[model samples]
Target chain A: TQLLEQSPQFLSIQEGENLTVYCNSSSVFSSLQWYRQEPGEGPVLLVTVVTGGEVKKLKRLTFQFGDARKDSSLHITAAQPGDTGLYLCAGPFTGGGNKLTFGTGTQLKVEL
Target chain B: DAGITQSPRHKVTETGTPVTLRCHQTENHRYMYWYRQDPGHGLRLIHYSYGVKDTDKGEVSDGYSVSRSKTEDFLLTLESATSSQTSVYFCAIRGIGDQPQHFGDGTRLSIL
Candidate 1:
């Protein structure tokens, strides 16, 4: 069973559009991370939110952690074709060494 | 891809055959993990290694075995390949037991 659930399994949008992806879970996590994976490449870490109610930004990407650390969200402001890829949200093991339980990935396609 | 590397970038094998995937890291990370990615299911943890000769099973450990004989290497084995086991496998390395992980390019395996 997947601990984290992502909304809109697949998405297609034009460039400059704003989009948001959600990652929800019932269990509290020590930390949650967002990663983007391109074809034939492994996932590249985007951001990690360790504290509840924390927000981080990277270029045009914004990430927020839930107040209870049970959920997280990734919002891309003005999406671009380069942003097209699989976005995965993962949570580290609650009690152990960095073993992550990943969410049911969100596939995004941005058209230029 | 990070300092971690997964060999046999692509493989096609017949059912019931045995296969092994290697994950090598140059960063000497203490924690290493193996995960499989499939459509809709996202990436699920199959196994992980915390130290030399210390490995543990994850939620999806059935039929998959792992080993860590050294700090720089982790191996995953499929005793008998099956159609259901066809997926892209990824290797991850982390500096500590609870930090963000770096991943390799992944191995695409096909079971016919």
Candidate 2:
């Protein structure tokens, strides 16, 4: 069973359009992270939310962690072709080890 | 990205052949991970190592094996490569248990 489930498996829109992707889970997490991956490359960490009801912004991208800590979201404002890629979410695990369980994944395509 | 590197960026091998993918890190991180990405399934954990000779299975460990004999190297091996095993594999590392992870470029493997 997938620990994290993502919505809108595939997304496509104009470069200037805005979009949001979600990650949901039934279990509580100590922390949650969002990553953006380009074709032929490994994913890069975009943001991490460790507190409930936390909101973080990186450039044009905004991330929100659910109050329950079981969900998260990534919103991209004025998307660009450069933002086209796969977005993934991973959850909080114990012991400080890199044992994060990841979500399904949302593939985004922003056209010019 | 960071100091991690995956060898044989791309490879095509026949079924039943043994294949190995290598992940090397120059920063001497204490934690390492391997994940496989598939459509809709996103990135699933396969195996991770907290230290040399200490490894554990992830959510998806079937048909795959991994080893970390040195602090700088982690290897994933397919005992009998199958078409079902074809996928882009990623390698990641975390400096400590609670730290965020860094990723390598990735390796594209195809079993024909």
Candidate 3:
């Protein structure tokens, strides 16, 4: 079975600080997606990267897919209290199925 | 929001009792999935349905069963609830094309 591991399981920082979260897996995937979930709410898709070394930006969040397609990262610039949440990375295996394996997750807390 | 709803946002029950969770979608997506989220395990797929009356077991389907009788509804059943099964459950839907899945708020189940 494929497993995705995320680094810095928990993070706390003051507002305006910058943070980066990483997701790694031994298995290569066809595509990778990033999501952010707030307390008491479901996760919302932030971006999907299909090609290796691809980068996508959504407002203050920047997502990068590794060149090997086995890892990905999310960077938040000038973090704010609104950016505090659980971030998860997920991807479908190379065989192209309707299923996706999700990363362990990184919880971020931005304080004022 | 892709029109997905999970019933009984929070449920508390005793061990050995039978439990059922319902997922309803208005998007008429062709795929629906059920996942359980734990502190360290991230989100593990429990079951998935490809179409009406067509379903498959996921990585963690030992104690869970799923049924899809309509295009917009999928039901997850726990034959005998166990304390280890206590976790937040999420329902997600995916369209036919190359689209990311959208999730519902989630159902929090506590088995005591």
Which is the leading candidate under lDDT?
3
lDDT of each residue in A6-67, candidate 1, tens digit only = 99899999999999999999999878999999999989999889999999999999999999
The collision pairs in model 3 are none
For each candidate, give the TM-score of chain B: 0.96, 0.97, 0.98
Candidate with better lDDT, 2 vs 3: 3
Q: What iRMS does model 2 reach? A: 0.8
Going through the candidates in order, their DockQ values are 0.93, 0.88, 0.88
Ranking by lDDT: 3, 1, 2
Please give the TM-score of chain B in predicted model 1: 0.96
Evaluated at residue B98, the lDDT of candidate 3 is 91
What TM-score does the A-chain of candidate 2 achieve? Answer: 0.94
Residue-by-residue lDDT tens digits, candidate 1, B58-95: 88899999988889999999999999999999998988
Between the candidate structures 1 and 3, which one is better when assessed by lDDT?
3
Tens-place lDDT digits, model 3, residues A70-110: 99999999999999999999998556569989999999999
* Residue B49 C-alpha lDDT in model 3: 94
Which of candidates 1 and 2 reaches a greater TM-score? 1
* Residue-level error in angstroms, candidate 2, position B75: 0.9
Off by more than 4 A, model 2: A94-97
How well is each residue in B1-112 modelled by candidate 3, as lDDT tens digits?
Answer: 7899899999999999999999999998999999999997778999999899999988899999999999999999999999999999999999987988999999999999
